[model samples]
Target chain A: MVSKSRSENVQIPIGPQHPALKEPESFLITLQGERITKSGVRLGYNHRGIEKACEQRTYIQAMYLIERVCGICSHSHSTAFVQAVEEVAGLQIPRRASYIRTLIGELERVHSHLLWLGVAGHEIGFDTLLMYTWRDREVVMDLLALLTGNRVNYGINTFGGVRRDVDAAQMEQVLKGVDILEERTKYYITVATDEVTLINRLSNVGKLAHDDAVRLGAVGPTARAAGVARDIRKDDPYAAYADLDFNVVTATQADVYGRTLVRVGELLESCKMIRQIIKNMPDGPVTVKAPRKVQAGEAFSRYEAPRGEDVHYVRGNGSDKPERVKVRAPTMANVQAVAHMLQDGYLADVPIVIAAIDPCFSCTDRLIGVARESGGRGIMTWEQARQAGIEWHRARGIDFTRLNETFRCGEPR
Target chain B: MQETQAVQAELMKTFPGLGEVRVPRARRIFWNVPYAEFARVFEAVTGPMKFTILCTMTGLDLGDNLGVIYHLARTSGVTLSLGTQVPKDAPVLQTISHVFPAADLYERELIDLLGIQVQGLGEGPRYPLPDGWPAGQYPLRKDWKVESLEGCKLGQMGVADGK
Candidate 1:
């Protein structure tokens, strides 16, 4: 057994409320000097008992609840849920609806990838890239609003098919928007490949070997960054992806930089996919009426969300309300891999490493605290940590107290 | 469809006397196994067949018996769902977290919500529940009464805050 008594390691607590994280999550990072020795995560700050609440709601009402699981991937959640319900009821969605579903799914992917790119830039202190990416991302946001009548939660997916229909005028607007995004994506790709500062910060920062990725169940761009080549859209094609042709991007770098490349490359591919879907979309009604009460059966549905594979398992028992509904978001599958990536990394790289997974903590905050047993020799409160920093600087011949007094010029409080 | 059949055939050959192996859809296969052989069969799939990615684990309250489902997938895109049930009186089952580390969270959720005991789950914490939660009060159980929780004592009386 490994020794649990490491007296020199400092356990740094980075928030259930920290500036580094986009949402509430606590990380107890054990640091030896500036290197991370071990890391443990504590979640459940945002758990709303959504799974238990699903059991009480009817099937139709559950879609709205499920859609709220993650705002960025709302369409992906509803699509996965509806697909499982349709399968349990033995209803095949119309071809046109399937095509439109694919359209909206690709649009959502474009938006999500751009949003992630902006966040990744902000994490690395490249706020310029963040600004540029977010500005370009609004193009896709506008297209989503035009096509689905909403920006964040589209609410287009119904039981058997889609609820909204796209007319010719909307198609023209969507195509024009895709053209602009494709151009912007090309520019961003060049920047990602050529920028030396970004490469220095990201390349080999948090290396997740391909084998470790597969063993640890890393999904989405995180897995693709390590060259796993496991895309659910291609592996098990659903929602008109079977008819679509696009490349699954992969990079062998298996670091933060590799993840950046994979996501940006996928953004380009999603743009191409949207163009193809719009050009070849078959003409028909957008929806087929579905029965409220499904027969006694169960089905599992999987969708390739922008982050990774989004899975939903539904069981129906001849009632309007579902017998059971289990949702596994991509963040849940990717969170474990974050612990592995943080090992032996520099303390400064923690934020970028965690953000590389694009962790949606709101969707995965349905878990409790983690228990760890280690020596508390390096544990200190926030005030003590600040004092330690001051003393260290004083020992190095940089007296901050004298400097503060000189700057104050004998002003008394 | 043939891929599903091939997987089913391989499973049957590997572990005989399985309860029922049904192909519910084109690419989906469901195997109903006895509770005793649950761990052994899961080992076979993850070890030999290499379905290392555990999608999720779902626990169901079947009134008299509690059911646990393991949805696993291989890198080559094949998925297999293994299910088993144990009597509610003794809701204990072997854990497969040793084979797939990803099952650690899922197994803990099973234990916390359904009140099932998973053997060999080391250091599994009470997940999706607060530390001060009452013991033996599983919310996902079919017979659990929400009204019974009203006016319940929380935490220790005098250790932190006197009641």
Candidate 2:
């Protein structure tokens, strides 16, 4: 009998649609004898042409468009964009409004990081850890829903100020939720770090060196995992970060476990920051009078989102419509490091490693892929294959024109 | 006068290729320079002042020209806005991706949508746009008339063939 070749082994497409990830992203993993040799992730199946949409909408309209960049971090986008515009217009956000913004942002972070922890637990085949974490995350969401009317994109923010104010009754609800979330987060942190199975699965897996972390320009927890002390909050503080006191967590291990620890530590820090905001928040006008037509100017703002630094830049031309709006979230920076993180790693570690970047498909779900290879030979490097495909398109008179529009900045719903 | 003079002096010394520093509004300042010296100016000022993070990169469709703006904010509480105007003849500027890795995606997106080119960024493929849009039909340009509902509606933009 002829022996079976490893090349003839099974290949699985994990998703442009899969239950494991909520976003429409597909990862093609070629397995050879029960070990993954290579993998490719495809995004943009859910590209909403956000950038294009923003170009058509006015500055006020674009604020809502940008907020939809990611559902989990919707406030972060809206706040970041608004802040950038406000900076350009030279408008000071009200003290109360700034505090409230910080509070809303931190609450979103609590839920998003917790949501990631749940998904991470699920990815590692720990259903119980997933369930417990998500259940706890619901409390944060419920609190957000109560505070902002909508659970997802709370339309509380406008250009220079907030749309609504938190009343005494609402403040009571926020206070209660903060108490419960603090307790749940404390317990979960213990379980995440102390659990034997979790430690074994995450530690030493998806190892990335500090040098690679900096060279690859990784951000958020991934870079922190590699012992790179770069936090947008610390490096470039925005919102209430400059006023608030919180430590940036770092780890020397540079593994999946280190990322988990950084996020967990951050969860606690966010809790502390939120509580401090509530106590120290000043009373004042929550909204400022913004110029209906923003004068021609350029500005940019950076926010520490759940994943990492979320940057929004806006250019106003003294019109209702902004000249241009650009967003650079942490996932864009961290995704570059994934190929390196996967190289030399075991096939089983692929999912966990990819998940470690906390890659957001909402931000990535755009663009069409060029299949450069025929018959699945798959010999060319990703870079080489991309270049070849571009050349092929050029030779064939294909116009790879991008959608020209404003990128509605925000989170995926 | 002293403050403005000192700022101008610092800017000139920092960016040798710097041409004109125009104070547009009360607080807003714009520095006009050639596309080649964008990174040099960014690196020169960002060192002592701690203006590390690149805030945003935006392109202007000036009818016949594409003006590129690099907004850099100092970590030491002062914000500095840098501007470079690239002529329509050659809408190419030096990529600040080396100085600020964050500019990689922003520059790529600009190239994708606005059709303006960045010289140094190691590009892969144009992201965000579909495979069939024609060359030079930059949707964001003032000239392109794309009536598709992709821009009009909020949630309904960029939906694939299916629902």
Chain B TM-score, one value per candidate, order as shown: 0.87, 0.71
- In candidate 1, position A3 carries an lDDT of 31
Q: What DockQ does every candidate get? A: 0.32, 0.16
Candidate 2 RMSD computed on C-alpha atoms after optimal superposition onto the true structure: 10.6
Q: Against the hidden true structure, what lDDT does model 2 obtain?
A: 0.73
What tens digits encode model 1's per-residue C-alpha lDDT throughout A291-361? Answer: 98889898988899999999999999998998888888999889989999999999999999999999997
Identify the runs in model 1 with alpha carbons over 4 angstroms from their true place. Answer: A1-7, A366-413, B13-16, B156-163
How much DockQ does model 1 earn? 0.32
**Candidate 2 CAPRI grade:** incorrect
Tens-digit lDDT track for model 1 on B9-65?
A: 889888877766878776787787888887788778878877777888989999999
Compute the lDDT of residue B29 as modeled in candidate 1. Answer: 78
**Candidate with the greatest lDDT versus the true structure:** 1
TM-score of each: 0.88, 0.79
The weakest ten consecutive residues by lDDT in model 2 chain A span A404-413
Error of 1 at A31 (Å): 0.8
> What's the lDDT for residue A217 in model 2?
65
